[model samples]
Target: MSSTTRTTCQSECLCDCNRPGAACQDPRFVGGGDGITFYFHGKKGQDFCIVSDSNLRINARFIGKRNQNMKRDFTWVQSLGILFDTHNLFIGAKNTSIWEDSNDRLSLGFNGEPIHLLDGEGTKWESMTSPSVTITRLLDTNSVEVEVEGNFKIKATVVPITEKDSRVHNYGITQEDCFSHLDLSFKFYALSGQVNGVLGQTYASNYVSKVKMGVVMPVLGGEKEFSSSSLFGTDCAVARFSGQFTEGNSLENLEYGNLNCSSGMNGRGVVCKR
Candidate 1:
């Protein structure tokens, strides 16, 4: 994903002309690839989400300074947040550090609702009901993977970035939002014909061409948000499905790889049939 993104981003940015080769700022992908693309360099103290075709938006936001009174400095990650139709879930984690975790089920909801982070036999997290998915932590690493079983998988890794404190902030870092971002990767196990999000919206489009440049950049000129939480990116998220989120949880793929998330029994909210 990074390789393809680099090639594509270089082709289209405001700093480029029809010239053969030149370097521009790091690219922020708003659309591309197998129904998936993410702005891994999410601003610190600013809220954002990595949207999927499931009409689902997953947010690992940071909360530190208010947008009205902010600076161009690094902000701490205060929560692991989630958003669906409306409701939000924020799990508490280390606010000072970006590469760590807090504990089991320390979270709150936007609607003041109660949410739980069920530990799946010490492997991953399975707590959502509708449009079920699994959150798996990569062992011996500072990253987590979210998967809709045989449907799709997303991995978000926090990479420590440092500079000489120059005023120039690339990777979408501006005065109000200058902090760490993510090293993101995505792979789909099975294609859910119905989809949403940037990738899903432009997966194989004729009107929106990736070769043209600006066509792929996600146009999100709207209000932004933020949260703070632990290492479990999508695992410790709050889900509000208008429909009943039910399925059988077999959890066959316990490691960090492609999984065959098949259902043998049916129930609501991460049900595992034994």
Candidate 2:
């Protein structure tokens, strides 16, 4: 039996659900992009809930260390926890579960527990190349159109790992450290035109997760001309947008598919009607 629930650490105050911190003020980020509202009861079968009120419906974004330098750049975001009902696990496991990173090197294993994304600047791995992160679809409006080609860069920062505050594990019970301590904010870009050795970029990181409908797209890295591709089974719903669109810029056209990148967001590259 395990339990956790937290929000109260004020220092920079934003409270957005993608895990960016001033620590504590988790009213679920009130209403800025109109995305933040949570309620979980669990135990029906085991664990499964991904917020409802503010309507996070379903979201995911992960793009790791492109070049590293955004407060030790090593990206993170995994708000997942909604399988409709399969007993959906993690942090509330039922079958096989255990995911540990504690700070920022990142690990993996899940049927449950994968809602982490840290860049709190603790730098230790000393990159040769491990910071090229991607996991998208969280831009509630403020201009957005990300197809990308070359020469583009965008950043928004915040970092703070963990520090434990209240606990009584080992069965005694009483676990209050919902998120030991965390702070991560992201928005990055790079991709304009005149491509050369293969360069492209895309940005969207404020974090949001619910992923788990078909389950199969998480291997990352293939072909390598700078690659990553995703579009969901199609219903108009969107996710996976990290790029390189040259050779006449792909997304088709509608004014380049309304390319705007911020202020209501926009990016057009549709082709998922299997």
Candidate 3:
């Protein structure tokens, strides 16, 4: 362990490696151009605060990986992933069938209109405000598109990959700890005043699941959607996006094509079809 203890063990994995103070994984700046990043999840790895940034980006996980597959984690029965927000995308899932609906399925998109909040949709849209995420436009809306599953007809964009430009914290997010206590509560967002939750907003603290824990998000990196691929192919293709061109957030001139992802019995998502 030379070279100054290997740069103090990657600055103690960006400050504070034994779990203490001042090393919340280093990027705590939070302003325009954005900051805040932390991860070390799954299987008793603990420490979470996925992200909250400018142009918006967050992850508990829908994070996929199939090509060059050295490693990647966190899909956690789908729970609390705020989305690549620029024009809007919010997701939360976890109700595989506690007799069909034990309540925990909130999916969203406004500029690409497709909001599905299963389990009584929060008591029929209790607090989704912004006229309940309203945005409507279609004159063939440039001939709307959707198609997925290897025959990937892609016009794909999943916005907000922050952390001063993430690569997924250069391999430091492992996944585990949705035993519930993120204190994530979002209401009425169309642009919820440009939500600077750093990347996904769950900033409340006083965690007590594993007997006292503290880590205030910083040092995150993770790739996105298509290019840098995390190709999903188990339940197969169902990509969804509604409408946003002149300004939805980020994603300009994206295109890819190959088709065969319109399945039956309704049990697949991430769809795009025309």
Candidate 4:
């Protein structure tokens, strides 16, 4: 069974890592509804649930390097696996030895098939299946917007660790791999009050944070609760997914040419105006 709801395009609906309800560099997360910031350092090479609603489930795969001086690994979100209804979408950054902004490192897959788009801004791909999904390139390379109609929209940008970052953070990054990763922003239209996950809990009406405030680096520790078996798994302890399609599953007829997209401040994300 399928459900439908009407949704509009609004600016405030966008949620970037710099804003509330985002997970960005080093896996730092800003609350969904609350204005709290915290870090979740799940084990390296592990997958964890970031968002789990009644109909939508999103998991992130962490990639990291063990710092010789630090106790824990320094992790970043390397890829995302999104499950809605019976479809699966995968977005990831391919590892590269030499970082080049001119080359595309963003990798995309739907269901089990690879997705390829043209090399230009405004290039897009639309799924022919029900619960329409659209992926649009916001830049000439390595930046895209994945929208599931009224359900949600995710803006993903592929990035690499710079030499300065490695030097300052003591990442011990080598020339073998640049460790390409993603910086993501999200916008969700219809989410249930029962939503739960690393970022989803903040959307609950009765949610209360347990994170310590006024600290140098407030961290949210729930590795067991948010751990998933795989990138596409919805078996996390706080998972609320039912593997069913909910309301607002229709496709929007957006004019790609009308989209005005620009890099956010500090080149953090892509902001689009319709």
Candidate 5:
């Protein structure tokens, strides 16, 4: 039997993009292969769920800073949400880091940088979720592949006026401050416990008018994470999907099943089943 249902967020839930993506796509998905998007209003101490592939698989809300009056402030809060879960797969942002986990059913922790900012501003906000992501399924087998791309633009300068030196006062920062933007892209393919690849790029532009570039691509030599001996071989199926997002944008992909892999999954040294 197949079932289709949709639940409007009672309030703003986390998945990142202010608009909806992923889950609301079609009919009778019943938790089929799809991902969710999320967004924030820049509130301090706000609590919302970052939508992921499944309700049980999303991220906690990105917390904002509190004011000297002990009130939650929105200005510097980290905006997070937007994630993907394929078959038994899971990918997300937790705390200040990005991570990938499976059915082991972990509590969901943050990995990598949580928020990306304009760059040269004296204060440093932690890394946030990537700008956009895309996932695609391989032909025949349940194995899947994903491509996540994004840009992080950090402000280069911050000037706040305060009467005294207080902890709350120290966190004050504004968008008018100097800025920098880092363009980034990441890609990963997982099958079982063996992962075939990982890639990332960081583009930096400082107010000093200096531009620095860095690239992190797949290291040809490494131990595989999704090997035949890994649980993915016997316990899980894989899918593929991908999409793009702007900074402070949240959206989900409800089209995992919509991908056509009849030509077979793309890539060498990788085998897929239909």
Candidate 6:
């Protein structure tokens, strides 16, 4: 058994929730590649697109509880479904009634097959199929990094909403469940200017944030535009995925050796040349 901690975007990567292109507590997102933070309160038990580009798609399933005092549910990202070049990857936090720091609660699957990694920090697994992908454990348990060469890197950590959180935010967390969720940070290597989704749109060259800035907590509204029928669906109104791979596609043509990378506040690092 691995014990759980309260993972925050700030602790995981170079770019965190306070910076840009990260998603954290209660579903706050920092996007626009300009550090504009906003809240996207997609309905509980629903799936929403976080990134939808021509060659890549990422969706999140939200889980939450309702408070009679509030008009909407208090939600958190429960899992991530990633689709790329005909492959599907799933990462999620397994539901637990009690959290222990030494107990592992992370669940992962690649192409519909369960992924089991040896319990140890720095343990890694790489895909055996085409289009190389890898997952590395950043800690002994509950924290890992998923990376697809020439595509994207995602850091996901499983966390729980503590009783202190419930008391402070009135989350009403009960003994039955602590509402484990994910704290995530992303780094995209070759996103197109036409990319669209909650976080993907901010990477577009012509993106203009719809969030109302300068507020303590800005909320982004567009549930219908970002909603998907399922965790792996790419049918959001603003989706740009074609769901088809052809010869000479960007994934096949990307120069793996010529990439120029630089550290930035937007993501893990900026790929100057892709």
The local distance difference test score of each candidate is 0.33, 0.20, 0.24, 0.75, 0.20, 0.77
TM-scores, in order shown?
A: 0.40, 0.24, 0.24, 0.83, 0.21, 0.85
Candidates in descending TM-score order: 6, 4, 1, 2, 3, 5
In model 6, state the lDDT of residue 217: 57
Per-residue lDDT of model 3, residues 185-263, tens digit only: 1211222222222232322122212111132322233222211111111110112222221245432222222322232
The global Cα lDDT (0 to 1) of model 5 is 0.20
Q: Give RMSD (Å) of candidate 1 vs. truth.
A: 14.7
- Compared with the true structure, model 3 gives a TM-score of 0.24
lDDT of 4 by residue, 40-120 (tens): 888889999999987889999999999888888889899999998788999999988778667889999999999988899
* Candidate 1: stretches off by over 4 Å: 1-27, 34-46, 52-55, 60-94, 97-133, 163-181, 189-200, 204-274
RMSD of 5: 22.8
Q: Which stretches of candidate 4 lie over 4 Å from their true place?
A: 1-15, 245-274
lDDT of 6 at 211: 77
Candidate 1 per-residue lDDT, tens place, 42-61, comes to 45455543333233444444
Residue by residue across 100-198, what tens digits does model 6's lDDT show?
757788999999999998878899999888548999998888889999887788888888888777777888888788898888878777777677898
Error of 2 at 34 (Å): 12
Report the lDDT of model 4 for residue 204: 71
TM for candidate 4 is 0.83
lDDT per residue (tens digit) for residues 1-274 in model 5: 0111111211211121111121111000011111111111223333233221111112222233445774534232122232333222233222312111221111112333222222221322221343243233221111122333321111111111121212233544333321111111121222112111110101001101111112111111111211112212221121111322222212222123222212211111111111
Specify the highest-TM-score model's number: 6
lDDT score, candidate 1, position 118:
50
Backbone clash pairs in model 2 (N, Cα, C under 3 Å; residues 3+ apart or in different chains), count: 45
